[model samples]
Target chain A: MSPQQPDANPSEKLSRYEPEVREAYARYRETGDVDAVQIVIIAMVREHLPKPSDAPITDEQKLVEDLGYDSLAVAEVVFAIEDTFGLRIETSEIMQISTVGSLKEFIAKKLGPKNE
Target chain B: MSEARVMPTDKKGRRRVVISGAGFITPIGNDWAGVASSLREGRHGFERVEFFGNPNVPVKVAGTVKDFVVESMNWRDWKWPARYEIARETLRGLAPHGVYAICAIDQAAEHAGLARGALANDDATGLYCASAGSAMMLHGHLGQMDRTRGERGNPMGVVSSISGTLNFNLAAHYKITGSVCGFVSACASGSHALGYACDDIRLGRLNRAVVVAGEELNAETLLPFAAMRALSPQSDPNVASRPFDTARDGFVGAGGAVALILEDAETAAARGARALAEIAGWGQAADGHSVAMSHPEGRGLANAMKRALSDAGADAGEIDYINAHGTSTPVGDRAEALAIKTVFDTNKKQPRISSTKALTGHPLSLAGAMETAFCVLAMNEGFIPGNPHLVNTDPVCEGLDLPRETLNERPRLVLNNSSGFGGSNVCHVLRAVG
Candidate 1:
């Protein structure tokens, strides 16, 4: 049997339609390109980063510590994501998002297949 | 002349209030020296700048503030060796005017020899400010809600864009323990703030007060005046604003911030602070007239000036100079002319009348504080700022002694008159101090 990937196992996460689903998810499903979703998400993240830097923002950078995003900046970034991607990310969902990579993966999974 | 003017202070003894420190960010200049030079040279601060890249806006000329720059939420200029990089978190709640307000207050406090952070937790020091809000932030906030169909909005939108934005930000940043208030009466808001601050000090409610007035100069805040047909369409920077002039069409828009420290005279003396000018007295009256138009006779303005003189225990003849609230608007200037005629003209003593608005365009909410601060500067610097552009005087202003050139003479007693939309009028009497 093939080795199981970390993201391959999904036990507790946001359902495809928990509150209201995003229209962008439907477009993502049509192409199933996570890279495209990550690119757009990263751009939005950069725009809302509280402390701008010349260094490149990596997917592994922690949102709160590395980006210097306090609660207010986090909310701004979340609002920007919801507006840009047509997603209604819940307050409970934000606590679980620690790193930029995790956020992108979680958002990408919402647009991925139902059965692995 | 109808009823004898009586001093109201005899009943409850009043404390004296004086202006100890002043700071400003004006289009004419940042400091007294710079502004005095501009006044003496008859220089105007008007500039033709594109607003929002829109070519259809009728008004183009404005008294744009100079040497002020903010990058990455950092205040970089306006004074040498004074740079402040506001954290983005705090900056989130501040509008453009709030930025200028903070800087002006800092400069004022520093000029007064008050140590940095000295006002924190100081209950005896209060704060009063006048601002209409940040139009650019308001526009952005409202546009976001509209675009999202109310799905998303800026968290700080309400506080950052509302009328009391300055009071909120300033009080918090300074950690003010005393009364924190905002005055809103259109262009007269600043005057109202100063008047009330003086009252607070005189009543012993507070030992000192920091009064600030600021405005945002952007297409959002300024272009709206164009819709009312209240803005001058003159494109030339040289003659765009001609207060009390027959050729004047409308007022030109300007923006900046001014702040002054109004403290108890005895308290200022004890603290070894030099007094710039004493806030002799102040008054206010309503026109009971149109919302957008002043009384044709300037009845409320005349009453305000009279009350201010009475409050100061002085007569019209006692005033050495009069800083007219002449915005150069055809109707407004004429009304003011009539008001001056009713007051000083009736007394047969025309103090060298002038509207520095001829040099610095109408700064709206910042007008009262700016003009009053100019009065303080004139008192200290020994010069009367000229109207400069009053060449072809309006017929109604013929009786008024509008000086066309700056006079190198100190004014002992100065009266400042300010009127706003909704017929709000406020006047203050300032006296030079040793």
Candidate 2:
């Protein structure tokens, strides 16, 4: 059987870190870095990840399955990201977030002019 | 270094409890053996507080643990990545007291060689601890909220500062399923935990348990004591912790943690675990007197000692050494001294008395457990503790032979005493099974 995907896009109306998302987008456009957001997540995963992968960063890698980050670690990473960007991650957004690529995509949408 | 050796013959039904392993982090030393050596060498570790200073308070020096990093602790069962950065960030919110709690337990578990083979979760494995939760965890979280002007703050960090954090964190770490308790009986908290760990084994309730007690010294915690004039008036670190001396003012605040792994004699022997000193007996009592003052006649502490001796099936004259709950407060020291003299007559060669606090300053809840570990080391290594700042003896301490100088000898039986705030008193009679 095929695995269950998030039936509906949780980010459709998800608005938590409006201010931080806007600020991060402005910073990303200039520097291509999310002003410590990605760094914080990297730190959260690198702490206990058995072997920090050498592969190029991508969006499809599963947090738990590929990176070996536990649920607790994922929560911590999310918390740090929200704190760094000054936003709150809704449960719906959290349910849909399982990969680094997906989190960045979600952040991009959250930071769009219309979303802001 | 290893703990003192002992052998309790297999009993028919009743069980014997032994201190199998210990881990200590104190101002004087990082481990139990090192701390014992420092005591024997008449070295003190107190130094002026570097982080916080108040010109108004006479309490200047504090016994702080030097150069400690949680990354250095040995982790078992839990896998770690080579380029670990995530775990460090995730755990950055935990308090120093909580971190020390984990280190002490991990060290004890490793010292007992529990890492060699993993054991299944069962009711026999238990944890009992005494800790004053992390002030940093609390104040740090609150301060962040105030600084950021944020309405919501880290609630989990606040919970981690609660006293039960150690019980939850360590029990889950070791997979202990039995009775797990984190007690707070002030200074006697460690003794309370140790005594009851002994009880649980003796009653056949648990096969083995670890007892730990720890306190975190911080400027905020020290300020109240200074305000109450409960800390040493002297600004110098050398004479700050003069336990039973006439010049003694009050205790220099020091903080650290100690862990002692206890096992049933049969369980230890079957597991091929060597025994440290045997916990012969433990007696506890409460002084119905004032909360701030121990009994003037030292009746409460003396009663605890008498009961412990009786429980050990030994007499007063049999005890060769006594570890007094000497905090260096004028009244508290006098009360403990009076209690020792009352329990063991000074007419004979009074049991050589010493306060390990003189070296480590009082680690509050960690005092009793750390002292027990020190007693075991002193026995196996034959090192008597001496007061480096013993200039003049108080009137109450005159009759008692407070080993003013370290003796290069071993003691057979020892009594460890601890009295806390709220009128709590406890005594443990330890038999050096050398």
Candidate 3:
């Protein structure tokens, strides 16, 4: 699968180290699979959340209201993504993202279509 | 220097300002008793620290704070007021200096017996602080932005890491409704805060004010001085910060916070608050000279001292002791000694003098606040601090009476002088009050 390919349900619920997310991260680590980028992004977001919660984070969850990501925290997560994927995210690009799903989609666009 | 003294106007109906409470977190100690003991015994607070994990760093000695928690809001073990259980949300907006500020203010408020939240929404109360923010935090935040090309950073970075961080976080924490401001004249910032706070009270602009000055200890803050060759290279902590000795090289950098509560004398009396000292008068002047060096003859400092004396309607002879801004630098100490002689000797008065910086090191912008607070302690404790480690005084200090030991004498009038980078000078005159 290409890095730009969205999950079956882009708004699907996610949590830290959940089975499928962890599985994707392991696959990404082992094979450099671009398809696991979304899961990797979700895991990074969960790690940056100020407060831990049992409620699974969804793509629809607002970064500010639901995940408690202030502007700085948002910057932190974006920087983390850039570090992880060797990508450069712009400030304007960050502003276009509001919810978890939007962030994943934004990263998907930044990563571009898979290498043919 | 002017030979004619400017007499103060009639003060029959003028409001009077008094120092009701003061607190500090210095290298010596947190409380007056402990600090006094250290000063009297000539005990210095310098310690060698690993500088920025760099083996080639030239300076290693610093006067670090003792008996205080680092990177934590909990000061319960430090015996601070119970009101210091600061919420984590508020802590998020504060830098290390801001934290020290609030902690010092907590002690001040409790010492004044101010009811919890008494200043909430009170427009008559003011908050004034002298701070240059947290260099460590600023460096980290800016580094993140630099590495990411400004795409990512901490939301609280600007407010928590700049010079005005104190005014922002402190005013919000205390709910100050009056003038919330930060003074920025470098080392003279602390004295400027106190002097202006006194003005507000004396002029009836404010009935009460909390004044603070704080600095942070970190490689980002201290190492820059090493680059400037402004830090002492002496490895022995005891002799590193010799303020007036001819052999003195440079100041030993230090960090901490000091706070004082100024109140209308009548209001303090009504509230049954004890006055530590009466802030008689204050004066400020500029050198218009170098950006980082004092005037060769300390002319600006002399003018400041003269103005302060004139503002108080007192003669130079009336001053029993002087707390000199002697930071042990080669040029700076000589300049200050010359300034002292120009003011007092011209008036033919030989007041006892000493620089407590020999004990606490130079706390940068907060030096004035910390040293003035020391003056208050000396006045109340009936002793004058010695110029410790002054083995060989410079020739410019020829006529000055720099005591070699703490004097067991009570001073009726005390003067504290501070000079900052850019040659900004501020002086305060305090009178012992019952």
Docking class of 3: incorrect
- The digit string of per-residue lDDT tens for model 2 on B3-101 reads 434444423345778877777777788666677778889888787874454576566788887655432112211222232222342244345665666
Candidates sorted by DockQ, best first: 1, 3, 2
Compute the DockQ of candidate 2: 0.12
TM-score for each candidate, following the candidate numbering: 0.83, 0.84, 0.81
TM-score winner between 1 and 3, please give it.
1
Compose the digit string of candidate 1's lDDT tens values, residues B1-434.
Answer: 11212232332367878888888888898766777778777798889977667777788799988766531222212232255445455566788888778778887887777888877897999999999988877888898689667766776788788999999988988899989999889999999999999999898899999999999788888988999999999889889899988899899999889999998877777777778888898998999999989999999999999999989888898899999999999899999999988888554777889999999999999999999999998898899988888779888877678889999989999999999999999999998886
Candidate 1 has a DockQ of 0.35
Rank by TM-score (best first): 2, 1, 3
The residue-by-residue lDDT of candidate 3 on B288-353, one tens digit each, is: 999999999999999999999988878899999999999999989999998888888644768999
DockQ, each predicted model? 0.35, 0.12, 0.19
Query: What is the alpha-carbon lDDT of model 3 when measured against the actual structure?
Result: 0.82
Ten contiguous residues with the weakest lDDT in model 1 chain B: B71-80
**Backbone collisions counted per model:** 0, 8, 1
Q: Best by TM-score, which number?
A: 2
Evaluate all candidate structures by whole-model CA lDDT and list the values in order.
0.81, 0.73, 0.82
Q: State the TM-score for model 2.
A: 0.84
* Higher-ranked by lDDT: 2 or 3: 3
